[model samples]
Target: MTQPPPPPNQPPGPPPGGFGAPQDPPPGGFGAPTPPPQQPPAQPPYGYPQQPQQPQYGYPQQEQPQQYGGYPAQPQQEQPPQYGYPNQPQQPVQPPYGYPTQPQYPQVPHQPVPGAPGGGRKLSAQLQIVIAAVVAVALLIGGGLWYANSGGGDEEPNAKGSSGAATGGGEDGGAGGLGGGGKEKVPADTKAKLAFQLPVPTVPDVTDVSGSWITDKAYVKTGVNSVVGYDLDKGSALWTLPLTGQVCGASRHMTADFKVPILFEATKRVAPRYFQPCTEVGLLDLTTGKLVWQTSITGGTAGDKKVSFSEVTLHGQTVAAGGLDGGAAFDLANGNPRWKPQANAGDCEDLGYGGGEGGLVAVRKCGSYDDPTVTVQNLDPLTGRPVSQYKMPPGVDFAAVVSTKPLVVAADVNDAADDGSGVSDFFSIDEKTGKLKAKITADSKRYAPRCRSTRVEGCTQVLVGNGRLYLPTEEHDGSTGEYGDETNEIVAFDLANGRMVPEKTDAGDRYTLIPLRMDGGNLIAYKWPPYDKGGQVVSIDGGTMKSTLLMENPSDKTTRTAETSFSSIGAEFRYGGGRLFIADTLISKTKASTSLYDKKYLAVAFSTAG
Candidate 1:
């Protein structure tokens, strides 16, 4: 049978909600008045299983109705002006104590004195001296107040003083120190400084450039039909490996030695047949900048057609590729066939596989096309056999594997999530027994983890490590009370019982913190840049939940603009060895109307080392 045509690619557009856009604060708004703090609600134990009140296993009904998820219900009131923009209707109020106040002067109408020569009366020298002294005193007081309130006369807030850092270690496999186990080196100073930036390569049209990785010696990134390794500190190209066709899929995880699996087309894209089947699989060695091996397989009823794949992953010594053509596995070292697709009972098909340090898990589909049953299976890496499997609840036609080891899967059950994010619930299962351990309902409007609806491993902003699931809460009003200034925080839920952990790491005012990946037991996170600030990278200790500032990008106008060019939704972020690399997954041709200020970047790097 001939393989199906590839899916059409959507044109890229600006990210929604005006994220990273600057807005003026409302007049006289220094910050919103701080509200009295309330005691936090009691948290359930990690191991105690709590039944959800709602009928669905993953979506629990909340006691209070909220305008958005994870936020408290508010009394009906007029909608506030958009963040970063001024509100004209708001009346000016008296300034707070210690704030500079305009000196008040009596508004007495000027009257010509009978003995005066002009329209205004003249004052004696003594009276003039008194007026000068009062004016001078007011200026002195106002200047002092302004200096104190403006961050001690500094333009930027000091990173060290503004944020708290984790010291020593905590229980439950706490991330001991920066670059845990000395596998990655920590800079003497964690304040991030600009290292270098790579200009976006000129593409004839819109192109896909989706892969990136970090190593001790280089930062590797995929370009237009090529992969380039750059010096970790200098941003200069160390090596470049060109390919015949465009890269279609790349594994998120790499082998211990830095070899990665990637899927590409058999030939370069040409007219009429713009997209070729992504059939070729290859292992790329980052250290040597070479393709160690490349191979393709034949499948279908006749066993003579080349199998096409939409995704690929590596687990131990096996590299697995899967798609509508079914799934196949090969030896990672020699590209030898390990297992080929076979007819399954009940018309079941292996859609894709998720592989990592933990193990390899496959998302299997069964039943008719209209009504499908999806199952998560823990497969033996060497021999393609399921050791254990957990059947998903009915109506879950698709599932994204968040993690393979602890077996965390995300799904949109019965079209309830509604949000395009493709997630409404998370299931934690016991891999050994294929039993459901816990189910946590995530409200689509409240949480911000995103996954591709059809891809098994295409998940981002959600991380599973140290027995917990970490996700970012939707951006909300910051306490500073400045209109248009929004922020968010990362909260963790216990994997054992689906109960939320009490501790959370705030993104601070105007910054949005997103989980990048795990570093040992620590969570590496990227702080999305606000209009006036540069992006930041920090390490959040898994045990204590304190954040140690890792890399702080430059806040200058040009640097800030460049750093934020990559949208958070589709960009790839990698942090290690005291550096942060941000790269765009797709690049399109610049339109004639595009302004010079609207510069595009292929990748940007920042480091804390000199």
Candidate 2:
């Protein structure tokens, strides 16, 4: 489950009436006859032979047509319409069931979930105590008769949080709860930030998004100073921060424990013009969008930072950032570094990994584009240091590498000075030390790496599950020696060891990666959905890539979310002008030519509380 956005000073409640999950029965949302879960077949109650059971006196089970499944139909007894409900459009009501289409009724908060028992049950994951009353098929038969007032409905009624219905996400950039129209509720203050940067955050500017999560947020490049944030809940911002140095990342505002949100922001900066291109990071409060802390990041410069930045993710008090300059871990409070022994060896172009806490691989590069060697460096999350210093063997000047999680693969070229025909290698770097763990050689020139998850630990066999590592690269896409676009072949490496995993083959093409949502055995990839020129996510496992529907256009169906902890929850991300994660989104969008100094920001909201 995605961590809930860090709790703010709980805003007031929202408008009473609004569209939410239907209060009526979940009548096969898409019309699939949901077979009653199989438990055990029906059985006799008393253990003795057959005998007619006595029906109750006042509240006997109504022998309505719905009470019997195989019995013959009786003569038509025209009865008055029940409860003023429609009779003309009478649905084929089953012996003991409700209508075909659900009723458009007001949601009574205490409705129970189907399949559960006991005068209505409640299962709040946040509460960590699920009240499950196992109802067997046999029991249900008797239960059907005994339940004139017991049709299970175990949901919290009015003014209750939709905590149970919440979902996991697959991308970055904290998301805003969109209105029905699919349009964002950006405020006037946000608009101004988009145009330019103010020293202090009058409003927040969000960007570097994965799905709606911010892989990275940049405050306008302040010569030495900077500002940035990881606003998880009230989603994306049109404006982005442009720090004049290497850009690391922060996470969304949510509590820790990976449940609720916890706000956090931290950055280390290297002043511009200090080291050819300095590596500077910014920290911002998500709620009000204000500056928190900043310091210089090394190994990568501003240009490197721009190229390396990824989304900001939250997991409890830990903020995991992967992109530009590999990935790093940080403390949500006070901007103190939590990760250690960071890349002091080469320019960390980007960072990512699969199936583990913090990060698994760091996309390390040395020299320049023309003579660059891009390799995946495995980093220890607990200490923020390289797992090992194994570098990809020399003579292999590579371009870029991408990861989903656990799996760290790269795209490389034999010789940068050579034409596009140069040999290309796509291989997995064992933990660290760049030893080829597993690899495949392919022919092509435009390549990129796409992992399955940005996490790396405790899942199936290897953190990187059963899948293919796709790299679409071009050769002339030069290792330019200078800053230039290089190209290489696009190849797909099967993640399965074959002996242990399934038989599979993947085609290579220009590919982009989106680790949207992969919880509960479901891995969803929203390929090139938004930031990618008309990207989409498809189910690469069960479905074929030939169909555009799978990876074509992504609906608002995503599930990636930030990791959280209590320590993280207590910290603030963006703010309304109070304390980020505590303040409100500015009302600048409500008026014209708005200035932070001119008027009070509008507190108009799409907040979880609001």
Candidate 3:
């Protein structure tokens, strides 16, 4: 089918004010992402790789541009991949097939953070300006597109329901999925450029993102109605489908070996009855923005309902969905049910299913303080048959699933008494046989996800904006079966065991550690604390754990009584223009005094940056 050529004007043509080309690709080379359908860890879905910015390791250190001084200082001269040279992502390994799909980050209760009793020295005026510059540029550039996409012109979104294109979200829903949601509908004709709008009506949270930077294509999830994908270079909607809800997207994309889009969606719905629907998967064709398929399991929002989750691949296919018994799998091409393991009902827990030269691996768990059943089963992605299953020690239960190199890990969770004291355990199980490969746990207090020892449930699966697998853990307590407190620490571990980087944060209730790409290899971490307190977005120094604060609360320096919670961020390509889309947390309705957190109601495009 010959498609309509893009309009006369398009992006990748010239920069605003015809500035120099986005120079500073990383030192080695551009993180070249191959064409179509690949693996996990979706990353910067567009542009050339910027210069490399090494993150500091253990202690707090200052970030020096000299460390990434390899690339030429010029921003122009960036080009596409060469045919003969094999361009692999300079980051994490390839993701699985049949990727996850969603719009906004799901609303899960995060860890509680206490306001730090102490205060650090206020930053100097010079430091504040530098930090403000990045954000200001981001806001200024992104805001323009956000306005144009936000239906400044009447758009018939619900009418041409399947077709999509919006202004990138502004401070409202500043990212991709943020602009598209269950809110008021927009007209179909209100087409804005890449920085214009996100595909989803709300912003999907940003999780585990990693990939080579290239302007080939990117993916986005709008409201429950559909998921839209686009070509990164041109910034246009490839396809759109009516799947509905705020969806969450993965950071790392599958490698080019597989002929599929690296992006997908997963949505969670909050009903009036306090019935939070289970999570369901959504897949989109990156170029066409078409809804290729959705999960078809019973009880799941889109058939697969799950709280904790994991996904694995086998024989070029991907499986790892939640079910009444456990997570299920489907063929990537046609959403075919590949396998269905017996239903146990603990919590369908997290999943890790992958098939490679070694063998197929699948892990599933079900249990908690109330749902009692701790079974970790390893199976074949192609056969859906279990080769082994491990019983979580009686003291602990499995929280969410995490992906490790040679194994699939579950941040072991300890059952808690009514008093709220929990235990912790960490184990890296063989992805092939489901056997316990390695287990780490602290003998003292429970291992908390926020601690340096306890592994954050899905940390391994998290892809820093750069292409790498960053697993964050605290400590694991397998004995007493309780999780630790936030006082421990947060660290980004190199899955390959090359180096363990412990990143620090000022936020007390730090939960997840988010990584974003700014320029070349330069990466920044967005630490979202659990409570109403604002978090920090830090620039890391590869050699030291030292961080440079890029942004902080401008007005609300001290934690205010207002319950402000940040939501997830989504990564999507901005079509027909020079922009990347994202879903961000503008403001939430939570009240701090109540000790309550509100689920994300909407996501907006906060700003735009290269």
Best by TM-score: 1
1-610, model 1: which lDDT tens digit per residue? Answer: 1111111121232123211112233333234222213322222221112223323222111111212112222111111112321111111233321112332322222345576776578566576667756854553332211100100111222111111111112114222332232134446876787788888887667778889999879999998788999999999999999898999899998987899999988888876546778889999999999999999988642258888888999999989988887788889989987766655334556789999888988887767889886777777777665666666766689899999988899998778677788888788877775655557767766678998887899999999887778888778778776876788878766565454544567888899989988877778889997898888888887655788777777888888888888898899998887888899998886454275458888898888866
- Each prediction's RMSD to truth: 18.7, 26.9, 25.2
Q: Clashes per prediction?
A: 7, 165, 158
Winner on TM-score (2 vs 3)? 3
In model 2, the runs with Cα more than 4 Å from the true position are 1-279, 284-292, 297-330, 338-358, 363-376, 397-401, 416-423, 430-435, 445-467, 471-492, 496-537, 542-610
Alpha carbon lDDT of each predicted model: 0.67, 0.28, 0.32
Candidate scoring better on lDDT of 1 and 3: 1
Global Cα lDDT for candidate 1:
0.67
Worst 10-residue lDDT window, candidate 2: 165-174
- Can you tell me which runs of candidate 3 are displaced by over 4 Å? 1-215, 229-239, 244-282, 294-315, 341-361, 365-373, 387-389, 416-423, 432-437, 442-524, 527-610
Give the winner by lDDT: 1 or 2. Answer: 1
Q: Highest lDDT, which number? A: 1
List TM-score per model, in order: 0.71, 0.34, 0.41
| Candidate 3 colliding pairs, count | 158
* Per-residue error (Å), model 3, residue 600: 9.5
